[model samples]
Target chain A: MSDIVEIHMPKLGESVAEGTISEWLKAVGDSVDFDESLFVVETDKIATEFPSPEAGVLLEILVPAGETVPIGATLARIGPAGAATGASPAAAKPADAAAAKAAAMAAEVAEPATAAAPATASAAPAAHKGGELLSPLVRRLAAEHHLDLAQIAGSGANGRIMREDVEAAIRKQLQPAVSKVAIPPVAPVSASSSPASPPAAKGDKVVPLSRIRLVTAQRMVESKRIAPHVWTSVEVDYENIAKVRARHKDRFKAETGASLTYLPFVMRAVADALHAFPAVNSSVDIEAKTLIMHSEVHLAVAVDLDEKGLMAPVIRNADMFNVRGLAKAVQAVSAAAKKGTLTPDQLQGSTFTLTSPGPLGSFASAPIINQPNVAIMATDGVARKPTVVGDAIAIHHLGVLGLCYDHRAFDGVTTARFLDHVRTSLQERDWEAEIG
Target chain B: MPTNKEQVAEEVTYLDAISQALAAEMERDESVFLMGEDVGQFGGAFKISKGFMERFGARRVVDTPIAENGFTGMAAGAAICGLRPVVEFQFADFISQAFDPIINVMARHHYRTGVPVPVTLRCPFGGRLRAGPTHSQSIESYFAHVPGLKIVAPATVEDAAGLLISSIRDNNPVLFLESKYLYRRLKVPAPLSLEPTPLGVAKVAREGTDVTLVSYSVGVQQGLEAAEVLAREGISVEVIDCRTLVPLDIDTIVKSVKKTSRAVVLHEAARRLGYGAEIASEIGEACFWFLDAPVTRIAALNTPIPTSPPLEDAVLPQTEEVIETLRKVARS
Candidate 1:
């Protein structure tokens, strides 16, 4: 084994490609043990302190504070306390070979030839591949240190730079001005280049969407594009449903430990209606030009995520679940979505979707169809208003039901019939029969 | 205060100013368009975009069905696809039909995905024109509860044009609630250029010192009228027009309240749980120490807006109510 050992920055996380050096714990010529704190680096998400991997005297500090470097770049040199300045024959040979292999890999990766050539040519043939050209090791180092090869000057054999050469360049550039360091003024890249434009200017702050939000946006856009949607709204007399809910509130809560919401009852009614009118519960296979109807109901309930808006998590085999089960499922999925703990499986595979604006006071709303699904049911706020029933004016608990369907898959008559079924099921209080 | 140009130009309505803003923006940016019921040939329920159909044509000045939800959703989709769509609700009260698209979808678009919904909803709101309950409402508070939605209620004709233009260009979903009562009643000279009035900002409509009167929409005019009356009585009142409600321009409210140490919020909406509650709460939270007296809110009585003019006048907050609230707060 060679006596000289190379010190490189380590990869910290899966997505983090580079980190900015926040501070250096030690200086050049400092003796450090393996696993000793060396420097602190900051990434967009988090900051962490890196430790030395090899126990030896730090021959050179190759990077400086406030400079960003990539993963696996040579951060420093660690060797025996009194080792010779020149690389050992054995060490130098493999380093040269590694560099040569990296150069070949770089050529395959299609890295900018002009930018990487000098570093690849100067590094020893073995070290050329192993160092900066483009090896797994160099890539990892570049990611950790956030080092851009285009900026560094390579000093390896034939001007082919290795990892060490890149690190040396970074260290030289970052060093404090000892004798009026000739620093070039950073030119304004562009008006848009500023991470965030100043507040005085008409600028905006953009935050990237989390995984759930991204999925929601994509699904919504897809739904709108794929589905030619037409909406029909009808105000239903929720008098019976509200009365039933009020009467059995305590009993339902005691039995299930879950408050009976209009949502679960609505979901149950929708499921029963779906059973009768399967076409409304079907999805179109755009590629196959076929309508796929499912016997089992996988109902997606739209859950409000407060500031993050809405996400739909499906309740699988919803037809089999009772009102209590539906409520539990809705609550669970909603909790998972709000907390952002929902797995991919939890979000996928729904035959139909339901959305409600709750008490935020929308009388009626046409919900966009969840793509691939044939229809979506949107329930509006329940308000006590006067309604005419059989030529008699009565103060009924009125709630508007908005049904938006893909006209390509289902016709207005079919959707209206399905909505009628939903209305009848809710008014009848036949929960057990519907569940059965 | 009539300038030569203002005296020469036909006295344009507030709705006309808004139409001018839309026409100007559409001409300036190819990405800007208008979508609402009867916006194209029918011109709009209030005729705000009357000549827009001829000027911009069908593609840009779109006539949508009475499906508030559908059109609002379509506008949101268009906005996401890099188009600036100004959607008009025939009556602000009818906006309830499009709540999901506005609050759930458009308002949350940016915060959820960093994708902007540069969509503007121009609603002819408020009561007193005998439009009755279904047509008359001031539901701006309903949208103000939403996080990413910017609510602008422009009082003056300048703000009517500027805020509508600003709302059109904003990178967030904006609710531009124009008082139906002010549609034809207010007037101003045509703007030199189509410049946007900043959103989430307030302006001191009338300067005073004894008490600060904060209001928006038609209530702003009432507040200004009340301020003039109070000024004669030696009560210096500062009247503030809260142009945008959601981004409440709390700094300006706080600053004015700090100076006056007394405030009276006037609105034509229902007194209980109206947007006045929000303003009063904000003032209490931010300027509690600076306040000499509790923030008083003078709003319409909690009742369905009546159709009879006298009944409507009785229920709605008038200039007298604003004056009364100012006097009360000032004395306290």
Candidate 2:
């Protein structure tokens, strides 16, 4: 309690790296209570006041508002009321620091701060010391490696084991075992790596990318780099679904508060077509030269987040939902996506991805397949065009459905037939009943 | 598949993105309109809608008297009548004047009668400009407590447009907190995407294997800066931009914490019961077993912002603080 308690910048958010001090409620030498508001920190995403974690006199203020600092940087310091400020070299001595650390560790264990203590204590055998402390990560790693904590030398403060320490111990134990067994010769690392790009040209403007843009760019590049893509498209008459949509859109909106778009119809058709042509709905295991045909139709719908980037929120079990149900599900998921309310689970485990370029009036498109999904389908714009019907010229809704697939997973004919099945389903299905 | 509808983007300031989003929504939907003090003729205090009055005409961008409560209540009424009204408060601090209408009238309209009240309140918040107490305040926490009120604070140019569009389209009361400090500071390639950025979902500004730093609004910029500095020191820090306040994205925070085993919540609002507290508590509860260090929070001092630049500087949470804090937490 007599030692100075330093206040460091708390990690604000998972992605936030720094913060700006906006204001300070207390001036230097102010008698501050524990958990009292101290100062405001404004980051790229928020501005908030920080409370004092410990009670003491505000001995120092290291940062001012408008100045930005990285996460974990010390903002200020608190000390005992009678302790001298501006100079506390005695506290920094190795012996004193060790004592302070020991006290802190003891406090962490004695208090309810370490929530895992009860569980750890309950699981411990009689041989285990009551005072021995291990971080959850170290504890888990110890269990996984089947290593006794007592045997491993800890490098952390006060002999506390760390992840790196455990990893080193594991490596040391594996070396002798590996030397005794027959081991294959390891390949040399690549010698010719691409050189760094030349410095920016004179008078050239440099632009920094947002996180979403960076991720999208990386994923797109990786997808294209890894997979050899083959695209196939089919022209289909959408008159049946268009008629059904025209009849039920108004009533559908009234009942469900969602717009009845052609996407859900396309989704249903694709789901059925995928079942008919399982090869088109699969993942390619390049090394094994095997195709994993996913039983569940987890459709990943690529939602445009404007120029920020794109996110593919998955709707699991797409085959189970009918046109109406799919329409509701798509609407809910898309709305959640647009509103930034999507959970992490909604973004994973997609067997197929459906991207619609129809609303943007695209006639035909071949979108990149989302990773782990063998193929991606795109719905193009539908228009009323004159076509031969029973040898007579008639106006009908027409559109193109395109599929971009992993060439390694299936041949061109598989995608071609898959598109044909989808086209046939859209052109001839009982859409009215499906819409209902 | 070929996404032939790829859009060409132009660079713009954060303020211009907001203006573009407002105009785009107004043009896209007939039910959407604007109401605020001097929003029409004056084009807003910061000139966010400088030419909007001329472009959209007075009918869509209506000017109002200096009565926040009156205009707020009128906007709520208009929303109930099947119109999406975007009400702009000159300063977020002034929102307190219309708190009754926002909390009592607009917040619970749908729950009480099932008829949606689609009203978007655009509040210019945050400090660092030395505008003094009344003009600069982070008021999201106030409305965040009220149920049914969605609060979104976009830190990037793209999100400023996308989230605003989603806020206007949302069929409920939404407080769109536009940071005044970021109005002209942050810039991005524009032709800004009008796609709606989903609310309540957190964006990972930077992915890292070390500690997780959570923040929103202006705090995000600080977090990014801190991460860059820490990266040079071989400290991999993950920064999460919490775009929305109400319906806080605890899942994203929890997930990140589970991976890194350490978390630090940063913000520019008062520390006492600030939004960061909620995040810290959530991480504590959700990732207790995964935590390597206690969840830490860095935020503003609980005091009204001052006019003097130096005094204001003393009160705020600076980037250095965040850096030191992150270093300590990461190592510990």
Candidate 3:
């Protein structure tokens, strides 16, 4: 028997050329038993503890922990003391291992240093069998698009797929889908269509868009891309609500310490309408092909941030609150949004949304729906207009409410009915009594 | 008539810039002195110290015999005694003769003791003048492995002045590897801001988005030339000049490689175990996910340089080879 048995790194799996010595279980000169765990080796595929081939006193450690080396590199040496003669007392399969060792020793004597050659040769085809020869960037890009690597042709050296090759394949795949539709090339530009900004003039001030604005832009584009939208509008008579506000405005402000606004009245009507028409207050799980009709109306109110950007903070359980209670909650959330102090929780879980373009004197504006909500309504300007009432020309306060909905959630009839319900509640509900 | 700033910006060669930096440091500090063979009355082997003996006097600029080990050891002792001694080697190839003093004595002394050794050895290195194997050699890879020594190889005329001053002022042993090929071939506006180019910071010589060429010393000039020719064929290339080999600024290299997704490391040293291997390995580990192709290396053949011009040209990295590598990487 040899005096010293050199411990070499074992072949770790297919395509594993090297591994890191993550840890050593025993220090130098420590006694070892055959088939006992020795050290931990971590390769790209797995981390495993290797066992001692020969039981002896550990003589020397060539490769220290935290160092990586190629396969077949010497790791340590086991001296003759306490060495096993032919088998071990605790070996799991002594006969099989002894025969294998004899064969390996014979092979080693025939071709020294050729142990790793066959392993490397066997690993090459197994590596090429999976992904063929695509670079890391190309592999990630292909995985992102759910592309089959075997189908795409590579143009790099040795047919290795490069980044440009993957990108070219993606462009080629998109051509047929685009040209199949005879639609005009004048379609609205997509978010990814124009990655670069238009050239600026010599005197132009090029300030990068704020982070909030960028996020808002990306979400808006994503919402449009996923949802097919349809818009519906309805005119509401606010004459009765205006008269009630005239009677109770000063008292309501003095009692609540908050100014009475038409937003609360509109929010009250919206909540009631959402309860009446549940489909309009529901979200659609497109992947699952199901509608989620939330029981409570968590209303997301759009707040403008001093012309910089927009934020939508939710008013939890808006349906449970009356006009005055809704007024306080809306004011608190709007103030928080303006002050940049809204928590992430306050901005999520909205089942319905409302955008007030009326303050800016806009009419019949179509606001994008805040996802994953199914609908968003815009309350436009309110003004006194001459209208015919029972065959007589009369002056009335009126406003136009526009509702944009995901067509997949509900059809045009549902959107129209939901808006009309809000209009009826706003025009005929006892607003004076409710405020008092 | 030239304005004050214009007169201050008079052009100078790379060799003149080196001479000016040494003179400036010696004048600024009384403790600073120059010691090398023929550095005094003979005015240096390359005429770098032509007027140093007359201006600073013989005491400040002392010439020594052709004994590298003796003078190098003397410089180490002088540095420990609080004097800034700048030693010059005629050719970087001859540094091996003094390897014992440089590696064993000067390099480990400061680490063992808290005392600082401020010795700067000026080595005129690189091959292009048919200086044969003994005279034309790059020794950066040899010294880069040492722990206590800082290595800086300046490519441009401006850096030849600024980096040397920084090395002289540094409170550690620094090997200032000056390129003998670019000593006269490169020129820059004189009156260089003699401000120290901080060690371990890389400079982007040219910016492009297609592929990055990481190099230093003479390789930087070759990369720039290759980038110029590749631009005509619509292949963009970014060139990074690693001014210092020790305390390498891998951040800049990684950033460029991340943007370009491909890289090529170039050097004039032998391909086997050269300084470029370290840079290439660092790039592989840092920018693994961003690589579109393997990190290629274009360097001298793994053989000693021959005396013949044609043979030397074949051994050393050339602009055409760099251009070809760039084209391959850019397309990949």
Candidate 4:
């Protein structure tokens, strides 16, 4: 049997379903001892190292680096030192995947020891709908969210809407993609959609949705419902900025300890264009049915936390900032995000948005409009592309800029103009003037 | 059930209702008299017996010194002689001083000697006035356990009058509890003929199919309020006022509970062995299988009433608590 042994992923926590393999510490065939960190895995909550249960040689690594597989799936295998090729555990067949996923999900949903026994829902409900009332807090939430109380089935006494039911409904309202129509006939429409709620899954492994994921899910649903988002994209040539940045890259970093990136240059152009088209730097008060335009542009920059989630911390009042200042603000915000010390106020009061999916290697994206705010712009990756320069073909630093604006505030033409303005600003910024 | 058709009358305050019941009973029987610390000249502590002296004369409305134990013994002696005596304690807390006369003499007179002690002890009770622990007490729960005495607490003006008259006319000694908070606050139609509502008969103050809410005195008022709030959200709450505690109207409670499959009992007394607990136990025994949820009890915290307005308010059971308990019970 080659004495082959497999090191499956361990149960992480009560709420963690899957963990990303951040790095494999021991490569295949590396000799290891018990308690040695074999690999590092990162859940949304924390990054933990898995230790070798027994002293052995590291064998085949099943899951690769950066892949987020269900927890308890085989990460790597180990055996007696210098075990030959046939000693490795065979790859999981088709049947193994489903079973592994279910086990991983079960661990995430393990109730705390202190959790009281749950109330059974399937017990034949006593006949008749009585006037079982909702509490003040639950009522307030239903009113605030405009949820139909009749539509929500309460887990409360006599089918009353306890605070928990309302909270579950509020969470479900955020993900319109999973609304009644979208929830396949597997479960009832009025059933709880909370990640914490137990779903009657025959083969499905449901895990609790992380807090960040819940918030993003809600915002995405709200933005789609409130704003008629119209997107327009324009390709830009960044050859001049590339040359200017290449010339002063080392000096800029040495002096300011900040890498001069195209984001700051793009942010500078966005601020300038926001000033020209002031209507774009405004929010829609849907309730009051009013449009509020801002004199100063508080630019929200969408920073992806290595795909854990997205956080758009505002670079408050970016219009007055030059290229260097914008770069510093971007760098400061990104650093605060990495250290997880960003203040609450830093996240709010965004009048316009600039998202750099460029760093994440996206060539083009139609990002959703950050609601209340009239517009959001996605900075696509800059790559070398051939362009005709006065009838001669030449390689240039090329990028695409996409703008998604609220059509409630303006038409497609105006949004296109705003997008064109951003494209022109990026292509024509006098980079040498600022570089010197 | 004898058919005596009763007519609606004008509205009266809870205090006036008590006053009218005393005057009407005294005039009808000629032997019924009232005695308390300030009941005659000063018109009682809450003026519940106000103007009784002017109409009934000093002989009938006899004012006594601040001696609950002494005067209560005298009243028990008078009841033994065929005089229906209604004795008032300024606040219910002082009833503890008269516990000997209540349990030993008046409560056991009919059983011990076959002579009916038709004495009604009027106790004005309940917290939430910033009244300290001694003054604001719901003490019926203590005597509710006594075998010989009938504990009757009234929440509305109508119940206060109807139950008081019934207490005065009963053969056994009765503890008539009137919530001080609801004394002059709640008003109901005055009885044109002083028709007494039969004792131990529970009144469904508000009806709903979802759950049955059993409460007495001030707790009934809170249940009504909780019902109104819940009704706005479409939760139908059935509130029952168990006017008489000792001879509880279990039939009314059981019927409502059996229909709803959920029940909750509420009172202003401390929760540990409170009257509500007695009702809960009875429900568990009688309607065990019919219940969809465990019977719940809502009562004041098991602590003395605080003098601080906020603290005292916190100690007493609230409509919010009733709403919360009923929500859980109905769902269960």
Best-performing candidate as measured by DockQ: 3
lDDT per residue for candidate 4 within B1-332, as digits (tens), equals: 11111113355778777877777888889889999898888888887766678878999889998888999999999999989999999998999999999999988878988899999999988888888989988887789878999999888877788899999999899999888898767876644346798998999999898888999988889999988988887778899999899799999999888776678888889767788888999988887756656677777665677797755655566676577667656654
True contacts kept of 1: 0.00
Model 1 scores a TM of 0.43
Per-residue lDDT over A168-187 for candidate 2, one digit per residue giving the tens place of the 0 to 100 score: 88898889877854454476
Candidate 3 per-residue lDDT over residues A269-388, each given as its tens digit: 999999999999899998898999989999999999999999999999999999999888888998999999999999999999999988778878998989999999899998899988
lDDT of 2 by residue, B1-332 (tens): 11112223355778888887887888889999999999988888888777778778899889999999999999999999999999989999999999899888898878899999999999999999999988878887888788989999998988899999999999989999998999888887646667889888889999998899999999999999999999999989999999998878888888898888878899999666789888888888888767766678877655667687755664566787677668756764
Candidate 1 per-residue lDDT, tens place, B216-301, comes to 88988998888888888888899899988878888898899877777888888876678988998999888775555557777765
Q: Which model is ahead, 3 or 4, in terms of lDDT?
A: 3
> What are the per-model C-alpha RMSD values against the true structure?
32.5, 22.2, 14.5, 31.5
Best by lDDT: 3
TM-score of each model, paired residue for residue: 0.43, 0.52, 0.52, 0.45
DockQ for all models, in order? 0.01, 0.06, 0.19, 0.03
Supply the DockQ value of model 3: 0.19
Residue B76 of model 4 has an lDDT of 96
TM-score quality measure for candidate 4: 0.45
Write down the worst ten-residue block by lDDT for model 4 chain A.
A114-123
Clash pairs detected, candidate 3: B10-B190
lDDT of 4 by residue, A1-436 (tens): 2345555666577677777878889888888776788989888888988777556787677677787776556566566666653333334311112222223222222423312111111112232354255444455567778998888887754455555566688888887855744646764555544447465679887777887999999999989888988888888999989999999989999888888999988888888888888889998887898888898899999988878889999999898888888888898998898778999999999999888889778999989888779889999999999998898999999999988888899888777787788888878878778766
True contacts kept of each: 0.00, 0.12, 0.36, 0.07
Model 1 segments more than 4 A misplaced: A1-436, B1-8, B190-193
Report lDDT per candidate: 0.75, 0.79, 0.82, 0.78
